[model samples]
Target: MSTHTSPAAGPDAPAQPQGGRHAAGPGRAGRDGGLGGVARRVSLGRPGDPRWARPGLWGVLALAAVLYVWALGRNGHANEYYAAAILSGTRSWKAFFFGALDAGSFITVDKPPLALWVMGLPARIFGFGTWSMLLPQAAAGVAAVAVLHSAVRRAMPGGYGHAAALVAALAMTLTPITVAINRDNNPDTLLVLLLVLAAWFCQEAVRTGRMRALVVSAVLVGLAFNTKMLQAYLVLPAFAPLYLVMAPGTSLRRLGHLLAAGAALVVSSAWWMVIVDLWPASDRPYVGGSTDNSVRDLVIGYNGLGRIFGSGGGRGGGGMGFGGEAGAWRLFNDIMAGQISWLLPFAVIALVAGLALTARGPLRDTRIALLLWGGWLAVHYVVFSFSSGTFHPYYSTAMAPAVAALTGLGGVLGWRAYRRSRAWSWVLPAGIAVTGAWAFTVLRRSTDFVPWLAWTVAAITVTAVAGLLLARLGPRLRLRVAAVALAAGLAAGLAGPAAYALTPLGSAVNGTNPTAGPAGSGGFGGMRGGFPGGAREGGPEGDGGPPGGTPGQNSQQGTTGDAVPGARYGLPADGVRGGGPDGAMDQQMIEYLRRNLDGATWLVAVSGAQGASSVILSTGLPVIAMGGFTGSDPAMTVDRLDGLVSSGRLRYVMTGGGQGGPDGGGSQVTEWVRANCAAVKASEYGGSTDRSLYRCG
Candidate 1:
C-alpha cells in the first residue's frame, strides 16, 4: 500500500520550522513528533490514532508466532546432526557450552556453542521433547518479525514508513525457507533475530549520533558472531560505513566512536573464543572440524575462507566444492531459486530507485537504512553465488531480512517518488516487470514443479504494467493504480516460494549441507544421500555412500553388500514424525544397545557422529563419536580403545563406513574387533545389515 504524503512531509523531506528558518537536517524529526515520537506514544490503549494500527501490528505478530510455534514438535529433531547436540547439551552444562554430542565431552559440535546453549535452557526445564528443544527457534522467529518492523519504522518515518515495516515483517514471516528453518532446531533463527537487533540499534545510533547505541549494535553483531562465526561479519561492512557516513558527528569523532565500537565487537565476538582457547585442552573435548585442536583454526579455516575458496587441505569438511559439476548458476538454478531469491530482483530495483531519488539531498536516515540493508544483501549475494565451498539453500535464510527490508521500505518511497514525477512512475513498473520476468525464468526450469506459477506471474506483470501506464493519464485513479501495482508485484514475488513452502521440503531438509525446495530441484537432481540418483548424504565427516557403496545408493546400502533395514539416523526423506521415536535410527537399535550394554561406561563407539548420535539421543547414554562428525578426526586411537575395553570401561564397538569418517584407519578396528570380540548378530538388532555390535573381550 503506497501512501502519498506531500513532498514536504515525506520521510526523506528536510525538516522545516513553522516560523521562518529551514531546519538544518533530516534526522531531527522527533522533536515535532517524528517516527520516534509516534512510536513512543503508541500503546495497548491506543496502538494507533486510526485504532487498527496497534491491533494490526500485534495481530501480525501473534499470527507469526502461531505459524512458527504451532505443532513445531512435529519436526522431531529436524536436522539430526544438530538434534543430537541439543540432546547432549540438555544433559550437561559442559556439553552445552562445548557443543558436545554427549555428556562425557568427547568431541564438540563443528560450530560454536552459543546457539545450542540458548536451545538447551528450555529443553532442560521442559525435558527434551521436540517442542521444548525447538521453542527457542520459534520464539526467535516471532521476535525477529517484530524487531524488523521496528527497524524499518525507525529508518523510514511516517504512516507510509509504518506500512513498509508491516510489509517487510509479513514477507519475512511467510518466507518459505525462513518459516522452515524457524520451525526446526536450526541456529539460523537466533542469527536472524540478533542481526535484526543490530540493525535497529544502528538505526538508533544514526538518529541520535550517540556512541552508546553504536556500541550496542556492535555488541549484538558480536553475539551473532558467537552464534555463527564468520557469517555474522557479513553485515559489518555495510553497518560500520553507514554509521560513519550518516552520523552527525565530525569525521574524527565518528572515526573514534567506530574504533571504540570495533573494539566492542572484537571483545564480544571473541570472548567465548578466548575462554574456550585458554581453557585446558585436556579438560574440554577436542574441537571437532579443526586439524589442530584449536577453535581459532576452525574459524579461520573450515568455517572461514575455506567456505569461500574450497578447502586447500583435507582435514576440514571442505569438499570438492559447491555446485559440484553444476557450475555457478547453482543458487539461481531450479533447485534453489524459489526457496529464497524470489524477491531479489525487486529489491535491487527498489534500492536503485530509492537511493537515486534520495541521493541528491543530504543523506537521510532512510538512505542510510537502504545502504545498510542493500550492502548487506549485495555482499552475501556475491558470496553465495560464487563460493566454492559447501553450501545449502537453507543458508539463504540469512539473506531474507535484507531482501524484505529493502523491498518494503524502498517500495513505499519509490511509489511516493513515482507520484511526484511521471518519469519515476516507470521505475515501479520496471522493477515489477524484471522481478516477474526473472521469476518466470527460474520457475520454468522446474516447470512441472509449480505448473501455474509462470503464467500467473506473466498475467500479473501485464496487468500491473498496464495499470501503472494508465495512471499516468489522470490523477484521480493514482491510488487505485498504485494498489494494483503493489498487489500484482507482491503476487509475482510470493507465488513460487509459497508453492515450495507447501511441500514436505521443510522437514525433508536434512544432512550436514541441506538444501530446501522440491527434492530433485537441487543440483544433483534429487535428495542427497537418501533419495534416488543423488549423492549419498554424509555428515561433517566425509562424502559419498558408506565405503564400497554406490554413489547414488540410499543409506540402506551397507558396506557388506547387504541392505541396512532402518532409515539412516539423520537422512530421513519423509516429513518428521510427531512424538514417540521418530528419526533415522530405528527404535529397536536403540533398545538393543540399551539392553545389552548395562553398567558400561560407554554404550558403544560408533564410526561417526551420525551413528553415535542416533543411539545417544535415544538412550541418553554416553556414546563416543570416533573420528567426530565426518569421521576423519583422530578423536580416539585403537590404543585408547584397547585400554578402555581391557579396563571394562567400554564393552561394545559398532562399525560402519561413514562419509568423511575415519575409514582410513582401515579394517584394523573392525578387523581387530571381529577377530577378538564376540559378534552380535543382525537378528538380535532386527533387519539392518549396517548394524554389527561386538562384545569387546
Candidate 2:
C-alpha cells in the first residue's frame, strides 16, 4: 500500500489541546474569571471548541435524562432483586458493603457491591424509594453519553470532531437497550458508564502521551469489573492495543507502561474480592452464586467462566433463553435485534470503509479510532454471539457504546471520503442503503407496530442514496444535495431505534430481561409465568404470552403471583403487596409475622431472594434468602439454621414458592425444617397450600 496519507486520515487542527491542561488558558481565564467563567466554560465548552459543541452535548444529555428518568418509578422497585439489596444497604453498612439481600446480612447479591454502593449511599441520604434507587443509574447513563462524546471528539480532529462527538452521544442516548438498562436498577448501566469513561481516559492517554491517564483508564476498567465481573474486561482488547499503538513512546516504554496499568487493574479489581474472601465465613454472608462460600469461586465460577462455558450452575447452566441461540446472527435475531442491532449494519460498513481509507496513514492516524471501536464491537459480538451461558438481551447494552462510537466515526469518515472524491465515496450511499434495508426488515418484524414506519424508512433510504449519487454529477449542487442526503440518511438510520427507544417510556419493561420495543417486539414477554400462588397466568395487554395462549388471555391476564400487578415481566409495581416470591403476600401473613417475631432478628426465611425481596421491601424487616438468588446456592446449612433457631435469631421458615429449592447442603436445612418445625396452616397466614410456613423455635 502507498504510504501517502489520505485526506481523511491526515493531521488536522486539534479541537482541544492534549492532556486538557491548557483547556483554560491564561488569556481565556483572565477574560472569563471566577464561578461565572466556570459556568460559561461548562455551558459553552472550551474557548477553542465550536459554539454548537457544548450546547449539542447538553442536548444529548438532556434527551438521555428524559429517556431514562421520565417515568422513572413506573416500574416501581424496577428489579426488586437489586432494589431489595439497595434497601438493605440503606439500613446497614454491612449490607451496603457486601451487597447483602437483607439488613441482617444473610447472603450477598450475586454481583459485586460496587453498583449497590453507588445506589445505596444515595438511598441512605434520601431514604430508599423508587426515585432514590434508580436515579443514580439514569445519571450514570447521561454521564456515559457525555464521556463517549468527549472520547469520539478527541479521536477526530478539526470540524469533524464536534459533529462526530454529538452524533455518538446522541446515538448512545437513543439506543433502545441503553434506554431500557439505564431505566432499571441493573448494574449494566453503571458498567457501561465506567467502560465508556475508561475509553475516554484511554483516548486522553493516546492524545496527551500521559501514562497517568492510561493508568486511570485501567483503574476505571477495574471498577467496571466490580460492576459486572468478566464482562468489564471485554473493553481491554480495545483499550490496551490502542495505547500500545498510538501512545507516544518506544515499544519497550509503552510495554512497560501497559504492565504498570495492568498491575493497577489487578489491584483495583481484586481488592474487594480479597477482603471479602479473607473475612471469616462465620462472620460474613455467604457468596450467593459460588459453589464454595468464597468470592474467588464466585468470580472464577458463576460470574466468570461459567457465564462463558456454562458450567458452574446457578442461572448460567442453561442460557437465559432470551438471546435466541449461540450464533453470529443472534444479535439480529427476533429476540435481540430491536435492542441493539438497529444501527449495527451501518456501524459495520463504517468500520470497514474507515479502516481501508486510513490503512496507510501513520501510527497515530485516525485508523486507531477504527481499531478501538471496531475491536470493542468485534470482541463483544463474538462473545455474545457464541457464549452459551446466562445471556440476556440487556447484556447487549455493553455493545451499544462501541456501536454508537463506530456509527459516529464511520459516518464522518465516509462523509470525508465523499467530500474529497475518494474512490471509496460509494461506501457512503451503500451504507445508507444497507442500514435502511436492515431497519425496514427489523421494523417489519413487528408488523402491527406503526405499519407505515418500514415503508417510510425504505422510501427515505432510496431518496437519500439517489440524492448522494446525483450530487456527485453536479459539483455546484453537491454541497446542498449531499447535506440533505446525509441528513435523510441519518434520519433513516435512527428512526427505527428512536421508535423502539420510545416504547419503554410508555410501558414498564421487564426488569430482568429488559428489551426495548413494543410488547412481543422480540422481548421474552411470555416468560412472565404466574408464580406458584395466585400470580396470574400472563402479563398486561400487548405483553405477549408464554408460548401458547389465547391472544386476549395472554395480553390481559395480570402478573399476580410471580410478578407485581401492572408491572411487565412480573416485576412489582409500586405499592404492590409484597408477600413471598410471587407477590402474593397476604395481610394475614404480614400480621402473623409481626405478632410472632418476638425478639428474633429475622422476620422470616424463604428459599430465594425473590421470596425474600418483597417481604423485606414491604416491612423493612430482615428476611433471609436461604439459598440466595436461585435458591440453589448452599448459603444455608442445617447447622447454621439450627444455631439461629436455637439462639432466637430466627423463628419462621416459608418453603416452596417455585423459587428454586435448596441444593447441596441447603437441602439438608429444608429436610430439617420439614422434620422438626411445626407447619402453620395456609388458612392462618392466608397463603396457598402449595407453600407452607413453619413456626420454628
Candidate 3:
C-alpha cells in the first residue's frame, strides 16, 4: 500500500500560479481557512469542492461501515456486560448494581450509564437483539476514522491532507481490534472514538485558541468518563506539552481554558457519583468476580484508585488495579504490542530525529507536538505500571489516536528523509521489502493456515510501505485512488486473520486469546460485559430467586446458556410454567413496573410512607431500592431503601420468596416478598408444568 503522491494542483490553487507565483509556504499552506481564502487555496475555480470532495470522506466512511458489517458476519455474540445489562434492565429491571432486591447478576465492575442506555434502548424496541448494539459501535468506528482523516489532513499539508486522512481511515477500517470491538458489544470503541475527538479538539484548541474548542475538549473528556472512566483521562496530558511547547505564549489565557475544562469535567461526572455514594453497601451485587463494592468503592476505589493502583483488577470483577495475577502483567504488555507495535520503536526514533532536525522553526512546533503524544502514552503506561492498577487490553485504545497520528507523522518524515538522499536508496525500498515479508506473513495467517488476530502490524507494515511508495509518486498522479485502494487491501488483509481467529460474537473467545473470557460465564472475568443473563439479566434485585435468600448461585458453574429462571410480570418466566400464585403476583407487579421506564432514560425512585409502591411495581420502572412500608411499622426499612432508591442508589426488593429477611422475616422467599415482594407475577423455577411465582406488596 505504499505510495508517494502529490496531486496536480488545481489551476486556482494558491500553490499554483494565479498567473505564475506560488501563493503559500510549505508548513502553513493548508493551515489557514476563511471563505475567500479557502476558495483561493482549494481552487474553487477548479475541480474539487465540498460536493465532490465530501464523497471521498463519505466513501471512506461507507467503506468503514461495510467493513464493520462484514466483521459482523463473523460477529455473533457480544460481551456479557451488555447482555446482562439488557436482560436485567429489560427483564428483571434492577436499577442498582448489587441491589439484589429481586435477584442480581452483575457485580464488582463500575461503569457509567451511557453504555447501558445504548443497549437498553434497542432491547426495549426490537427486544434484546444483536445488530442494534453492534451497529452503534460500528458508527463509533466510522466517526473515529473520519475524524482521524480530518486530523491528518489538518496536520500535514499538500494534497497530503486527503492522502493522510484516506490512509488513516483505511488503516483504521481494517484494524482487527477496532473491527472486533465495533462488531462486538463493548465500550472501548466509544472510548477510542471519544479519544479521537478529544485529540482533534485539542489540536483545534491550540490552533484557534477558541474557548469552544476548550469546552468541547471538556465535553469529550466527560463523554469518555460516561463511556468508561479514568481510563480515558489519559487524553488531557497527552497534548498538554503539545500546546505548551508547540504553541508557546499560551499562559495567562490558558488559566481560563483550564477552568472551563475542569468545569466540564465536574458537570459531567458528578451526577452519577453523588447517587452512587448514597447507596447502602449490602444492597449491591457482585458478579464476574466483581465483589459488591460500595458507591464510594465504585467511584474512588474500583473506578479511581483501582485504575491507578489496583482496587478491582483481579480474577474477580476487579477494576484495572485490584492485585492482578502474574499472567496479568503479560496482558498489559500484550495489549500495548497489540495496539501499536509498529510504532513504538519507530516513534522513539522519529521523536529523536524530529527533535534533532528542528532548528526552532515550525518544525520545532510540529516535532514537539509529535513527541508529546508519545510522551503522554509512555508516562501513562509507566505510571500505571508502578501502581497495582488494573489494565484492560481495550484501555490501549486510549493510546491509539496519539500513537497512530505520531506513527503517521513518523512515516511521512521517514519517506521525506529517504527522498532527500539517493545514498539511502536501498534503505527505503529495503524496509518496504521487509514490510512485504510481513504482508505475506499476514496473508498466510489470513488464509487460516495458522491463527486469527493476524497482528495488525502485518497490515500496518504494508501501509507503511504503501505510504512510502505513495510519497514517491510526487505531485502529479492521482495517488488518492491508489492510496485508498491500498488502504482497503491492507484492511482486507488484516480482517482475514481476525475474522478466522475470532469466535462467533456470542461464542467463547478463541483459546489463544488472552483477553477472551474464560470458557464458562462464571470464570469469564476478562470478557467484556462479563455479567450474567446478558444485559438486564437478573440483577441482585431483579433475580427472583428464593426469597430472603441471596440470588441463587449458579451451582452449575462454568457454563453459558444455562438459562437462570427469570422472574416476570407479564412474560412467562422464561421456561417455568404455572409459577406459584405468589410468583404470578410478582409477574403482575413486573408488568406494572415495565410501563414506566423509558428505555434510554435514567431515574431515581423512592417509596412513599404507606409503602404503597404499586407505582414502582405497576410501572416496571428501574427503581433504586429504598426503605418503605410506613404507619410507624418498626420493620419498614422501605423508608431507608426508598431514600436510597430515590437517590438512584438502590435497586429492588424481595418478598414472599422467603422469611429470614426483615424483623418479621419469613423464609428467604417471605423475606424476599417483604423486601421486594410486590404483588406481581414472577417465577424462578418449577416442576414440569407446575412452576412457582412470588408476590410482594
- The candidate with the higher lDDT, 2 or 3, is 2
Compared with the true structure, all predictions reach lDDT values of: 0.69, 0.77, 0.44
lDDT tens digits by residue: candidate 1, 393-504? 6677899999989988877876777677776878888887887788778778766665787888888887887787777788797778767777777777667665655442
Residue 68 Cα positional deviation in candidate 2, in Å, after optimal superposition: 0.8
- Error at 468, model 2, angstroms: 0.6
Q: Which model is ahead, 1 or 2, in terms of TM-score?
A: 2
What TM-score does each of the candidates earn?
A: 0.83, 0.89, 0.59
**Candidate of highest TM-score:** 2
**Each candidate: RMSD:** 8.5, 7.0, 11.3
Candidate 2's clash total is 7
What does candidate 1 score in Cα RMSD to the true structure? 8.5
Supply every candidate's count of residue pairs whose N, Cα or C atoms clash at under 3 angstroms: 13, 7, 159
Residue 184 error for model 1, in Å? Answer: 1.8
Alpha carbon lDDT of residue 663, candidate 3? 25
